[model samples]
Target: MPVRLPGPAVTEELDRVLGDRAAPGYADLRRLPYLEMVLKESLRLYPPGPYGARETAEPLAVGEYRIPAGTVVFYPFRAIQLNPDHWPEPERFRPERFTPEQVAGRARLAWVPFGLGPRSCEGAGPAMVECRLLLAVLLKRFRFRPVPGHRVDATERFVRWAADDIRMVVTPRKAGPPPRS
Candidate 1:
């Protein structure tokens, strides 16, 4: 089956965050929690799509309105992600918020970056593995620092992204030798 690729813009930003860490396999990628946190932050803010809609099979009451049977129900993913009720300190960049324990305790329907239900994004697993591998390899070989004139300003484009693009400098690591000039 053909795979759905992550958006180019998203991929590029991920590259910036991953730097020299791209790896050859899942095992290598599994050790980067920080990478995972970055991706989670992206999803929470921009999600692949702005909102998700579904048809209700039966009538239900949501807040003050009675949602009739067969009505289309819209779930605003980004809005919910930013909702202070479900996420405290929502505007901050926090990787720990997605640690296994913290994520598990959150409301089941919250943080639907990949959507929810059976039809959610099928590529979630592969994408995550790819990201992890990249982070692992990069962290092991280089150090990243933001470029002098660059700063990340996040915006939305079917997904949350750096509004001004993420620009950084990658410096190779010297493990056990001193440079002789």
Candidate 2:
């Protein structure tokens, strides 16, 4: 997915924001708003855990129908994230959708990449930090370009995965030394 996007533009943004900082501390990571947006949009489109199930503790009314207790309800993350009512051009990968203004305007649960409520993944925070740091450092060192003719599709299972191996050519980046202090 990274390879499919405008790699140079993203890399430029990372360089502009991070410079020669090999390690992005928590504070630094917080400042990389576009990077956060990219990650959020990616997670929204392809959540690792596509569906979550919860057994109702008590009878509930949804819309016009009543759901009995003990009914196993499935929350389809992909479907909800892709719903056109909430996301225009849902299939397109546009990280700007996660801008502060846009996010503030949306429903709180409009995007639930890490699930929601008490059952949400405990590792969500750490995982996001790890991903952002790794991506930042890696993008600083290398450029990933998709191999032509390689087909990448999201497959549904217990978790979402690439239907086939994603092929990308990684090229080492060549840039001048970081600006001196």
Candidate 3:
């Protein structure tokens, strides 16, 4: 199922980044480094989907083995993210891994949050902006914390989802007192 809403951490991160830069249509969301980091890390750890496939068109040598053309290949994003050769301390959630200079210097196709090549997600940019905006609005109004008896579990299907549903306590922020008229 679709998330339908942003998680609490995402919301908090956005607020921390935006601070006072509250503008409409994602103006405030892009200014946050930590928020971007969290997003990148989250995507790395748990991409929207489980895997992807491609058909090989020509004979190729993969790690000393020559496979004939026309073979179907599967790309497991989860495994790639956890590969020690590609990421250090793969299990840890570190957004700094996606720093501009760091990412630019990394191998191509290393981070495929929205897929790669010519068939990547067409809505990647807009979707990211939307996620940021949603998180910003939510963080400005409330805080989320895990409920006493519940934990978040995620499942991967066509798109990864919160397996047991995101059970959290949404405490609305107390508004400041108004000026005396």
After superposition of all CA atoms, the RMSD between model 3 and the true structure is 5.3
- Name the lDDT of candidate 2: 0.81
Each candidate's lDDT (Cα)? 0.64, 0.81, 0.68
List CA RMSD, all candidates. Answer: 8.7, 2.5, 5.3
Tens-place lDDT digits, model 1, residues 29-103: 444455677677756755667777789889999899898899988888878898888789887656567888988
RMSD of 1: 8.7
Give the number of the best model, judged by TM-score.
Answer: 2
| Residue-pair clashes per candidate | 7, 0, 0
Clashing residue pairs for model 1 = 20-138, 21-134, 21-137, 21-138, 22-134, 46-160, 153-163
Q: What is the lDDT of residue 25 in candidate 3?
A: 49
Model 3 over residues 38-144: C-alpha lDDT tens digits?
66777888788778777789987899888789988878878877777778888777677888887887787777877777777899888877765665566667767
Cα lDDT over the full model 1: 0.64
Could you give candidate 2's per-residue lDDT for residues 147-180 as a string of tens digits? Answer: 9878788778887888887888899986444445
